[model samples]
Target: MARTKVALVGIGKIALDQHVPAIAASPDWELAATVSRKGTVAGVSAYTDFASFLAERPDVPVVSLCLPPVPRFDYAEAALKAGRHAMLEKPPGATLAEVHTLQALARDRGLTLYATWHSRMAHAVAPAKAWLADRAIRKVHITWREDVRKWHPGQDWVFEPGGMGVFDPGINALSILTEILPDPVHLTRARLEFPANRQTPIAAQLTFSGNVTADFDWRQEGPQTWDIDVDTDAGRLALRMGGNVLEIDGQPMAGENTIMGEYPALYARMAQLVRAGESEVDLSPMVHVADALTLGERVTTVAFDF
Candidate 1:
């Protein structure tokens, strides 16, 4: 099989830390070019604009869009129209309607489109899903807290309208929940706390049906935490370190590191889609975020600095 030539847009933190390394390690993909106004990866052709990158490398059949959700649809539409397969970073678009539009465009063009949920590829997630398949779930609790200053220092876009401050990380927890749960659950109640200076929330408390509840806070002073605990009739299940490790009844279970596993799995899935001439479009995760915004009650909190 010929290697798929790919270009990356929006050389942000995630693109540099995760995607770049993942692509370099994947045998099926070659990082052909990059588009970013501020940063450049070593040894890769870098362009200040997407137009120049596309113009110079028209033969690159795949484009991975790593930009924030606000301006995603336009670029995704252009990529599909140009007959290139597209890989969209999570929270696919700012609005659910735009995501639907992208899906339609991909189908019309017969191009492969991937809306990736990197968290769903977590190591312990699949095993937990399999273990709880036959048991009746009683309750679920999620706690995801991190220091914005430490993780996203100087990332101003997170507070902008359509930036999805806390939801940026909270969406990962939701994605994992949606994948692990056996039954469908919808948001019943939600309270969002936004820093007085920002358009998006800094903390969110959400309740879901099937007796499931989630608490997501993106502002922690020190020592980050990401954990999910579930109580079932059979036993107790707990996932720590963002689902990279699992514990059952206070005992550790073997697990894989999804940070290293996600991109390779993503490339494999993309290859399969391109080979079959199909597009994989699932917006349930993003739909929940939009629904939360439309239906959730907003509260003002202390203004955030940095």
Candidate 2:
């Protein structure tokens, strides 16, 4: 069997640590090449610009973009037109409109365009969704607080205009919620905490239509917490470690309790989409972020220095 050639664009931290390794491990994918301005994976043929990458590896039929949201549009658009399927990282584009445009373009070109949401694909997430599918959800509380400095390190684009700061992490919770919940959720109110020296918020409190509220903070200390608690008619469900661990009514569920395996599942889903000759692009998470931004009131807080 010939593995599908996959070119990883923007070989940055995420690419090096997760995406590249996932592709290498998958039997269905072959790491063909890389496109990046300053980053590269070891032993992989690298090109600085897209023009050169396309010129050299025209046989590469799939491109996984691990780049930031701001410039994702141009690269994805170009890849689709060049007859390559694209698998995009979370928060697919800087704005919802651009992602929609890419979706339409990919569909028209008869290409597979996947907006990969890594969080929703976590081990315990699908089970949680199944557990809650028939139950009536009363409320959900998501506490997604983390130490950005430790996790993100020197990535400065996180504080820029399209960076979306705390919401960058917050969107993960939204993705999981949108997947598990039976009905759609809309943001009712939001209070964003912005550092005096930054353009985006470092912390946020958001309320959705169904009594679902999330607290997102990037300045957390000690152990990081990425948890979601769902109150439903069946029982109380809890997801810890960003949906890698699950608890039902305070009893931890057996099996499917693991981590570092989400990326492989994401790649598998992308491959399935390619083989099926279809595209799966969900805009719920991004739409929630955009709604929060539009209705959110910014509050300037203590300035943070990275």
Number of backbone-clashing residue pairs for each candidate, in the order shown: 0, 0
Q: Deviation in angstroms for 306 in model 2?
A: 0.8
Model 1, 39-145: lDDT tens per residue? 78999988998776766788899999999889888888888888888999988888888888888888888888899988877788889888888889999998988
Report the alpha-carbon TM-score of model 1 versus the true structure.
0.96
Task: State every prediction's TM-score relative to the real structure.
Answer: 0.96, 0.98
The lDDT per prediction is 0.86, 0.91
Where model 1 places Cα greater than 4 Å from the true spot, the runs are none
The TM-score obtained by model 2 is: 0.98
lDDT of 1 at 84: 86
Candidate 1 local lDDT, residue 6: 92
**Which clashing pairs does model 1 show?**
none
